[model samples]
Target chain A: MSREPIRDSVADLLADSGLADDGVLAHALESLRALCPPEAPEPSGALADLLRYGSEAVGAAAPSRAAHRAAEAAAGNLSPRVAPAVPLPPRKLHRGAAISAAVIAGVGLSASGVAALGGVDYSANPPQAEVRSSAAAPAEADASVPGQASKSPDATVHQAQAFAAAASGGSVAHEQPAAPSRGASDNALAGDGAAASSHAVAPSAAVWRSERSGAARAAAAAADDALAGIGRDDAAVTASQGAPRHRADSAPSRGRHVAQEAAAVAQALVAAGAEPIKEAVALGQQVRTVAPSLAGLGSRH
Target chain B: MTDSLTDHDLVAGVLPETELFSRVYQSLAPAVLGYVGARGVEDPEALMQDVFLSVLPRIGEITGGVAGLRTFVFSVAHARVVDHYRRVERRPRSVDYDPLLDMRAVPSAEAEALVRTGQTDAHLLIGSLKPEQRDVLMLRIVGELSVDDVASVLGKTPGAVKQLQRRGLKVLREMVSEGVMAQ
Candidate 1:
């Protein structure tokens, strides 16, 4: 018998049955092993690099405090079973008390505005400055209040009452809560200013958008000039020493004029009673009409 | 320090900087490197380092002592290789090789001799097989994994792996015989 056939049969048996128990298959496998030997060659420079990498990784493995806590938590080592129990008070109570105090002060001011106003020296406080501005700028004040009042009529009345009480000396203690209302007014002023500025820029922006004719281009340039004039007037008004420095700090220079205009409206609402709320609602209607005109001008330009 | 200590015993407490780790590294590093290198990975050594580093952290989790440890290490190596390919896919295009710049001005005579006669023949022969066949054969032979272990690594049934191994070896044997007859 040719050894080739025997070798072939052995190879077939080894392939079929795997490396178990057949002496002939084993012999064939061993002989063929030389053809495709196991690659046991040590990777040159790998050992050193591996050692270095492992050492560095090991060195860096020391957990940070937060990581250690997290790991402990993951392992259930930091579970509540291991923790000490202590009763903790709710924090919301303190906030509730502050709000109650502010409400009481607001009620007092609304109940007796003349008495409250007489008790406080207006020149000493910046908010008192707002009261004076309200008298000077009733239309603007009426314009700003209705939008806010419409959102929450009851809250606006309460807020106006709070401002009146705040203007009066209900409790200097309630000033902290009143600070947030002042901040709200500042934000409202800034928002109104931004809306007006957007309106003023809309026509020029439309000209740039269409680029249809010389008339449109000239209109765009006129709008730009008008915007520039507004900006210069704002700078002059803001620069005035007697003008409320508080308003300048509350809004950006670009929105200073709009902010001042809105601030005057806010002051009028605060100083006057519920009567201004109706006027503000009317002014709000006027604003709605004017806004469409501004948007239309942008397209026409 | 004895070789007789089971992998479970070695990892019974906190993992130590003991001789056991060194022994395991010495025994498995070459096989792991070979497996990674055989796959034509860009950096087999770095991947091998990753495999070992990953193994070190999770050695305690392994059961079945030495055998389990071996399976775990190879599994980690396989996962890392898959991750490497995934990363290569997501990365920006690799630089093209310039033959003029890449070619050695003067090839090392010793290195050339090693390439001609040393391990390249076996690697080249193994490379000739289909990817699945090649993986099964290498894991079985070089990684010294059992049929089941190879199946797990390749995500195939034991029967499928056996068939692949059988087919791969047969093709290898034929190629060897043809090379011999030519000579």
Candidate 2:
């Protein structure tokens, strides 16, 4: 019932039917032969007329035939039209290399910066820190002292701190090495019990000494500035002493002059002197223990 | 088996030569005639030409090579045959008989050749079989189409085509035993 291997030609059908045994299928094929005659009937018209006419000229099923042709043509044309894709350029910079390069660059820059800096002195009279010895500090500050040490970045921070403390009337005890005094003694508060104040204030009898007040210092400076004139140009002096931000263009020379004057004033304050009026400690008699070697053990034993 | 010479060769304009198309015309025209004639068309030859005419321009669109071309050629032939029947059923000519539209107007050369062979009654005998049986027989035996190709042409399953072929053959065998077909 199933002629599975398709019989493509008459020879296949005839061979399949009578190939092995010519007995049954041969006779059957013979009997079946009467279905159509031996000779094929030819057409009256030429066969080539079919091709000669084409679909449009024939007009037989023209509309639908054209639609089918169009559809099939679309499907057929798609395969050959494809262009090969363009390849992207290969990556040159990988993630790890970039990150590592950035880290190395940062480390190199940091080392270069640290190498360019000098150490913070913090010594009592480090370079230009000796206030009283250099009487002409303000005058020589532009050419010499500023070039020496006071113009250091660390020194700027100390100056800023001193300004804040002085502006606060010594209430803001700065944590920095206080104006080179830290090297001379332990970082002690400014008020009392300083060895220099207790013993060295008067070298002989009682040379009463105190710093000149700001107004008195200003008057003395104004009087000494002209050298020959009676009344001076106060406005000119004030204008010349511009704030640091305003004087950034000529900061090095002018800034150093201001710093040296401040240092001179600070040294004057540090110079040994007796206070005619002393501030007594309000804690009447707080017991202070002295070490045995220094106290003679009078109170301890 | 599929032929290497597909419809694409025709459609692609590769087979522009008349000699090339002759290959197609030679291969299919006779088979299409038998298939169209078996369906009882008045002018199977003319209709077969029409089938090819419809196929020619669209030939490039046909895929699956010659076997696919074979299927399409037979399919168009079948539809043309159907359209012939529909036209016949729908319209009646003014005249009682139009010789051009009449199969009886002309005796075929094959029928004439078969006269000496005693197979002269071939069409008459085949005309007696069921319409479906006649289709299966003519498509398979005369057209030499495969059972699957017959199924595709007839719009039936392979099983249906096979059953029809078997039944038609059995009927023919019965006719042969009765001396109706053999004579």
Query: Compared to the true structure, candidate 2 yields what TM-score?
Result: 0.40
Model 1 ranges off by over 4 Å: A1-301, B1-15, B101-119, B180-183
Instruction: Compute the lDDT of residue A1 as modeled in candidate 2.
Output: 12
- Look at candidate 1 and give me any clashing residue pairs: A140-A265, A141-A265
- Candidate 1 residues A30-108, lDDT tens each? 3423432143234234333434454345545432333233223322321224443664466663878888999999998
What local lDDT does model 2 show for residue A248?
26
> Evaluated with lDDT, which candidate comes out highest?
1
Q: DockQ of each model against the real complex? A: 0.06, 0.08
Q: Would you give the TM-score of chain B in model 1?
A: 0.79
Query: lDDT value for candidate 1?
Result: 0.50
Give me the candidate number with maximum TM-score.
2
